[model samples]
Target: MKALVFDKSGLDNLRVREVPTPLLGPHDVLVKVKLAGVNPIDYAVVQLIPVQPMPHIPGAEVYGEVEDVGEHVKGVKKGDRVVVYNRLFDGSCDICLSGREMVCRNGGIMSVVTNGGFAEYMAVPEKNLVKVDLPPELSASLPVAALTSYHALKEAEVKPLDYVVVFGASGNTGAFAIQLAKKMGARVIAVSSKPWVAEFSDHVVGYDQVQDKVREITMGRMADVVINSVGNAVWESSLKVLGVGGRLVFFGGLTGSQVNLDLSTVYGKHQKIIGTTGGTRKELLELTELCKDCRVRVWRILPLEQGREALEWVAKGKDGRIFLKP
Candidate 1:
């Protein structure tokens, strides 16, 4: 099988070459890749995450069809079109049994902890796959971005009439945040580049004018729920504009991970600083249902061979999500 494999961690190290197909296990399913979502984290996986063996394939979210199923697999079968949950866990663990599989101590993201779907074929655990009635394009992008945004909103406990501000709204997860917040009847303030804006957001502001515009729109109330993925870049501004008793959810660190935190402000304002990773399998299912026919704009689509170039482009930043068609 032809795949984008990296013997070392870096974009320059990535190469498309022939590799042996993955063998299926009794509790695993073999999927023939269709469309795979290329996240900035994919580059991190290739560059930073350590794997015992060399030649790692880095595609975190995949939408594919079942080429084969393991003997122990049930509730799904051959030829089933599915989405990979991307997180693997030991089912007997305390967190897994409590249904918070996203944070399972024994689990890690598929592409980072193991070889992911940057190839023609890959094998995944049966429990990590979810069936979705979606087109191949949506099947790829929605699993990660939509799932993460949905879970973040759920975690923030957004309610109707709440003022939701999404930083990096033009990016993958942020775009979904705009749509989902609006769908749930919240007034959405999207902070993005001047030329970029999603049709669903109630208000749009560029990074330069985020705080001012948000204050104007909310009449000094500021944001009730603020979702931020960009780290230090939006850190101060997000905190400045958040209303009293507000919530700020942090998941991605696309800008830079390290940042300064003010304990006094947090306590005085009674604000909540929530951190989340990926979405649960249950939330992925719900996200798919809510996103049915929902318009999600793709920045670009490249073939598997262009994986290296795709990583480079993603690094420079983009108006929306990018995916790989395998």
Candidate 2:
């Protein structure tokens, strides 16, 4: 098998080369990669995090065919088309039992904890696979990007007519945020430096103009909910634009992580600052339904050998989900 492997965590270290195929565990499924979704976090993990076993493959989102399945596997088998959930958790945990497995105490992500789908084949636990009914190209982009936005919107408890602000609106999860928030009946305010607009959003503005436009649109009431995946670059502005008693659901640290929060301002406005990570299996299942209906959009598809270049595009903050075909 040919895979892009990095002996260590650095952009320069990633290389596409022939490697041994992964052997499946008794309860695992070996998927022949059809499309692998490249996300910003893939770059973060490759360039910032440390992992064991010298060489590593770094792709978390996958749309593939089950080339083989263990005897214990159910719901899906060989030749079944599916998407890998990417989050692994102990089934016995309280959170897992509640179906919010992403927050389990024993949780770890696919690319971060084990080998991933950057290659021609990936072996993952049967529990982490979800059957899908969409083309591999479109299905590739939904696993991580759509699920993250879905999880955030659900966690925020967005109500009909609530004003929602989405930072990085042109990015993968941000784009999905726009649509999902609107579907939940919230009026979406999309922020991006690029020229992008969604029919679902009520307004679109640049970062420099977010505070003013949001205030003008809401008659100074500001946003009822703010989803900030871009991190510190817009952190202060995101906070300032929130209405009193607002909820801010933050997930990524794309720009920079550290931000100084004013406690007085927070309490004065009765604000809620919540943090989220990769979504649970339950949320991913919902996204799979959306995929079947062709509700999500993928920017483009490239070959698996272009994994390095795709990572570069993600690091540079491309406009939407980039898919890679093996």
The TM-scores of all predictions, comma-separated, are 0.97, 0.95
lDDT by residue (tens digit), candidate 2, 1-326:
98888987788888888999888888999999988989987897789987644688888899899998887777787899889998889989888898888877798888887878889999999988888888766578677888898889888899999999999888888888888888789999999776655544678888787789999999999999999998898899989899999999999897889999999999999999999887878788887775454444566688867777888898887756688777
What's model 2's overall lDDT? 0.85
Displacement of the residue 172 alpha carbon in candidate 1, Å: 0.8
Per-residue C-alpha lDDT of model 1 across residues 1-326, encoded as one tens digit per residue? 98999888777888889999888889989999988988878877877668635778899889999999889989689889999998888878999999889889898888877998889998998988889898777778777888888899989999999999999888778888889888888999988874456577888888887788899999999999999977778999999889999999988887888889999999999999898888889988887788886666788889888998888777778766788887
The residue ranges of model 2 lying beyond 4 angstroms of the native Cα positions read 291-297
Scored against the true structure, residue 6 in model 1 reaches a CA lDDT of 89
Q: What value does the lDDT take at residue 284 in candidate 2?
A: 83
Q: In order, what is each prediction's RMSD in angstroms?
A: 1.2, 1.5
